[model samples]
Target chain A: MKKIVVSLLLSLSLLGLGNAWAVDSLNISLAPEQANPPSPQMGDWLKFHSVIENSGSQAAHGVVAWISLVQVDPGHEQPVDLEDWSAHKAVTQAILQPGQQVKVEWPMRLIQAGAYRVVISAVDRETGHVMTSPFVDFQVRRKPVVDSGRILPVALGVPMLVLGMMAWRRYRRRTGV
Target chain B: MNPITLIARKEAGELLMSGRGLAWLLALSVIMSVLSLLLVSNTELSLLDNAQVVYMVMGTVTALGALLAVVLGSDAVAGERERGSLMPLLLAPVTPSQIVFGKMGGQVAGWVVMYLLSLPYVWAVGSSGQNLTQAVAYLALFGTPVVLGFGFLGIALSARLRSVRSALLTSLITLMLLASPLLLGPSLRQSAIGKLFDAVNPFSAAVNSFDSVVIDSQPLAMQINRLAISLVWLVLTAVFAIRSVRKMEI
Candidate 1:
């Protein structure tokens, strides 16, 4: 019984040490509430935006950030194309000093109409300390659109030509062309 | 007096006496010089900038050169006939071809002088770029043919036509046609049925040459097609002008 108690105490102490050693180096949060989200029109894609803060005493570097997205019920997580969003995992070079925060905008696309929940994560360079953003929810809808301004320039040009012709003819009659 | 020398000397002397040509020369020099200064300052005297500077010089000089060509060409035979000097020139012992060639030479001489007058200003603009030397080389060598081409059309038109006023207006129209690519390149190239406009247009060819030499770092080889087309037009107009002069009974 004494040996078993000693073994249990050792394992508990190790677990406590492990939890204590983990640093709180970074924090991330959505900066603004997107009240009225714009529909991802044609050629538009999905995007996630947030503010990342290095709350620790030292400046943070080698930051690898991610945006994980999932559908509501019966959820499935999918990887994002940084190129499509023009944001990447390698903001590692940025050194944000203590109390300094950087705004990150991530773009994404929805191929189908649905509800989505997005979560952002920021990992520190050396410590590997992680910070997670609040989950932001959005809805994507499908609709049809028609463009009518295609012929506007040409349509306006004809009337301008007619007015110019009338003025030119009047000038010719006066000047004897 | 021989037809060519007399007409050349007489026309040259008149141009020298007229303050109008000098005024244009002064304007051209000022304009080209200022353009060179602006470009040279931006280019920091790079060789490419130098070429652009030379091109700017060429552009300004050519404009002035074309203007002089048009004025001389429009005035050539028509102005003479309008002022009652055509009869004396026609009545001379020289044949009509000799008279035509002589008048053409005089007009060409005036244009050459006008082009020469812009050289100092051109050099100033091109001082920063590699094209300064190349431009000067081309100006002294290839520029004459261009002058001949533009001058030929104007002079030939004057020889065939009897009204200087009409010739002047037509020369302006021709200059606009020659430069249409500058004004109409995008509209004609972008709109519906743009393909036909690009294919048939000679002005596009000239603008292409300008782009190659001025904007792109290409040599005169790229402009050979434009040069050839211009030469063909020159030859056809010359033939027509000579025929018209030969056909003139008076």
Candidate 2:
């Protein structure tokens, strides 16, 4: 009677653990999730491109995106809370459907001029699956602006200005400037 | 003949005889047409392109018309005053209002002629993009007045200075001074300063017209604000120019 009770209890525990959950019928791939050698100019606008693909047999829905700025080489993650950068959770629209690949544009200006790494990935908001892209690397250095040779417009504009002034002054003088 | 119509014909006829004026007018249309074609083609590649191309071309045309109007308008009264030809016109039977109407008509006609020449490119942009008919109609109707308004404003300023050279320079200088305020401006329709700039700036008004017609695909009725603003400028310019002409001392 003691053995029978013990066996019955053990059987119930095993039955509970035996129930199965279904496997995901979708696959996701990310393209160039990292950007290297980013623009070094201070206050310069930056845009990086990421492409997403649904490789699985089943269509995926409710895709979500995640991007983080990280230190390169050592790979420390999520240094910048991009949500704080914008007043919204995501500056971009949130939802994407499966088997419908779309490009994601990630734009961020460097807060400090130095080396940095960006990691990007996506998952279905409904199903928790991560899609990671190839890593891209970027470096920050001094970007030249108005440091060398005269810009064409100003260079060209000077001559035009001279002529215009001369012509204008003459015109004004004749008719009383 | 109506006083306005007579003046328009006479001024347009005078401009026709001017080789430099004709050349500039043709060049402006060609450059604008080519630019319109390039811009339209570029926008055709995108789904969200707006009526900016037409805005740009019209802005250029209106700016030119305004500058020309000032240069020519100053020449109309100030030149006559300087050359001492204004006295005879003052002695003539026409009233200040009639003279104003005539001068306004002529200036308006000059702009209309230049606008008509750029139809091919203008229409092409419309046909290629959205709202081709609406764009053309807007340009034909409101655009003419916008052009006239700019011209008249330049002339009005010219009249006040009593010197063609001073009037032209003042108008051009005013135009140059405007660039900073426009770029730094926020909310052309919302802010008082921005609205004031739009009210005074013919180029801005013309650009607004294009945006309404081509980009927004809006009807002529919707553009009344811009048209009305432009007409007010035109009337003001006419009133001042006519007064200056009638009060001629040469």
Candidate 3:
């Protein structure tokens, strides 16, 4: 019974050590890069800075951080795909040592007008633990970049003009006008 | 005027000034008008970036230009043969190479008209975005070779194939194959085989160049390799068209 108890204790300690080794100890904080960011408008470019720090005793290997934007507008609440907003969505840090902090900047263009929440998420590749920063809230004012009213006239006018010309030409050819 | 220019003028006149030509132009304008209206008025599409809309418009224009080229070129030889007009042209003083060049000139004229017609829509869609001028410039620079290459492909097929229907069918299928990359999902286009096909496809090169220049705001210097691929396609198709016309049995 004494030998069995010792073996069980040893196995439990080994498992605890392994769990501790794989535990994620990363913290991330995200904020606008500018000290006082202006009110964002449609078509405006903005940048956000995310700081990832390792708060554990061991190094965190293969840390990847990405920025995500979610439209929080009442009727249109959904995560925005970063494909059109930003080209560089994610940044990778090969190894983050204990007490080491890595800063990443994401440049995104505001393509739509709405209320949005931006969050930075980081994952430790080895531990598969995901850590997300607190949300940064912002509102984009509407700036009419494309005037549909102006486009409507040209869109509808050009074709009408071409059709008129075609009809006139056909009439002239047929009637010898 | 030289025989080449005379022939080219005649071909272009027949294609551009005829009732059919006017009808095609009217159709193109209507399509552009509808596309622009939908893009600007639709809530979801309007929310897209202006540059993205411009890129889409440019892509559609290029495809339309290529389709017109293929249609015109397919009819260049086979339609004439069907109408019993090929014998006189073949017996003329002009060489087969000259005739091919003349037909290519006519296709270029059609593409020019198409490009001009697309500008207003491009401007209307992208006026509020970045790289508007660059997008227009790249469309002309890259679009010409792509359209011409497809035109030559059509002419080559028409010269070799005895029937206009077969020539048009083959040319359109070839165009579909070249444009297959555009139909692929983003992830699939990044695969090795997809990359290889895109690298060689003049159509993809034109579309990718438009994406890079218009949407991503990439500089022209970065697009040399893609431009080279388009030029290579133009040269290859031109050679093929000439050879086919020369060897065609009247």
Candidate 4:
């Protein structure tokens, strides 16, 4: 009787473990498969390619890959939140059979100069399986703001300003205000 | 000379000689140059994409054109009556409807001049990208209706009101309301209300049309809805202005 009870408990524990393993079978990894770019310039486009694989014995359906900015420079913050950053495009795969791999690309435009890393996550909507990629680190340096750009405003502003002043003075003279 | 042409030419000439005209030209010059200069100075490819440059130029031009419309048209009837200049035109053989048409023509002419002034900057920024001609074409095609809509709106307001102060203030407020979408955060701007505003506001429609054409590279079929909505707004405003002018007293 004691032996039978121990055997039954052992069987139930193994089943639970198997279920947990099955749910955590999705793997996500970054692209280039080599040394990533250490420093990318501001206003540059970086294609963050990701690969998703299902290592479980069962098929995964409705898998979603979410890309998010995990961190930035101490002083530099994104103008928008994580949702807006990823809102431009969505990465989703309808189904991934066991041992099947899929590739996805997240095109990002760097608007601010700073250090940043992106976190890619793959989630199975049906089973609530979640897999996260390691932080991808990169630095974006600032480019010099051209001084020549001011010429347009000055050239345009000065003449308009002068003309406005002349008009104001004339109006004052005519109305004696 | 045709009464409409005469009115348009006279109005155009007056704006060119007035302080307001100079101010408009000056504002356009500075804004355009500054935008170009920023693009030129930014060495990064992503800092200022060709599409982005085109978007900026088109948006600024459209917004400014709309502003000029309000500034000029807000005073059309009210200011004229305030200064006792409407009496002469009212007493003239030209019909009130003809005068309204003439004013619309002048507004269109002013917007065209603004467009012409933006050409150099548009060329400089747009040429950097592969689609200068396309950007210019979109600017011209969509820009006309934006000017017409806002111009007519201002004219209608001016015609309905007896005080130039009230007309100008109301016009400015309306313009601010139309442009308020620009101030919204990206998330909020993507909300239901934001989408509705973009579709309903002629100014926003023009900007979105440019974005669709230039940035997204969407074909005209995809953009037909936006252009159509803009045209509807323009036509409605024009009808309202004509009615107001028709019902107004000397």
Best by lDDT: 3
Candidate 1 C-alpha lDDT tens digits along A1-177: 999999999999997765443355677886434543565432235555687877777777767777776667445445433332233443443577888888887665343345667788777666645777888876666422111131233233333443454565557768998
* Greater-lDDT candidate between 2 and 3: 3
Deviating ranges (above 4 Å) for candidate 3: A1-29, A35-37, A50-64, A92-101, A121-134, A171-177, B46-52, B181-184, B187-196, B218-222
lDDT of 1 by residue, B1-250 (tens): 6768887887776665445554554555555545544554542232333444456556556656777777887888888888998898777788888877887777677877776666655544544333355566555444455556566667767766678888778877877766555555455677656645545444455445554665454688776776676556567767766776777654
Per-residue CA lDDT of model 2 for A62-157, tens digit only, reads: 666666666553454336545322222232334444455666667664433345666666665444445556565666553322111222333234
Ranking of all candidate structures by their TM-score, best first: 3, 4, 2, 1
Instruction: Rate residue A165 of model 3 by lDDT.
Output: 71
Candidate 3, lDDT over the whole model: 0.85
lDDT of 4 by residue, A75-96 (tens): 6555334432343455888899
Docking class of 2: incorrect
Q: What is the Cα-based TM-score of model 4? A: 0.67
**Which ranges of candidate 4 are over 4 A from the true structure?**
A1-24, A27-29, A33-44, A68-90, A93-95, A114-119, A125-129, A132-177, B23-64, B78-97, B115-143, B157-170, B182-199, B204-223, B246-248
Q: DockQ score for model 1, please?
A: 0.02
lDDT of 3 by residue, B109-157 (tens): 8898889889888888888767889988999999999998999899999
Chain B TM, cand. 4? 0.93
Interface RMSD of each: 21.8, 15.0, 2.4, 7.0
Give the range of the ten consecutive residues with the poorest summed lDDT in model 2 chain B. B42-51
User: Model 2, which residues run further than 4 Å from truth?
Assistant: A1-177, B1-7, B33-44, B177-205, B219-222
Best by TM-score, which number?
3
- Comparing 1 with 3 on DockQ, the higher-scoring candidate is 3
lDDT of 3 at B30: 82
Query: What's the residue-level lDDT of B79 in candidate 4?
Result: 82
> What TM-score describes the B chain of model 2?
0.78
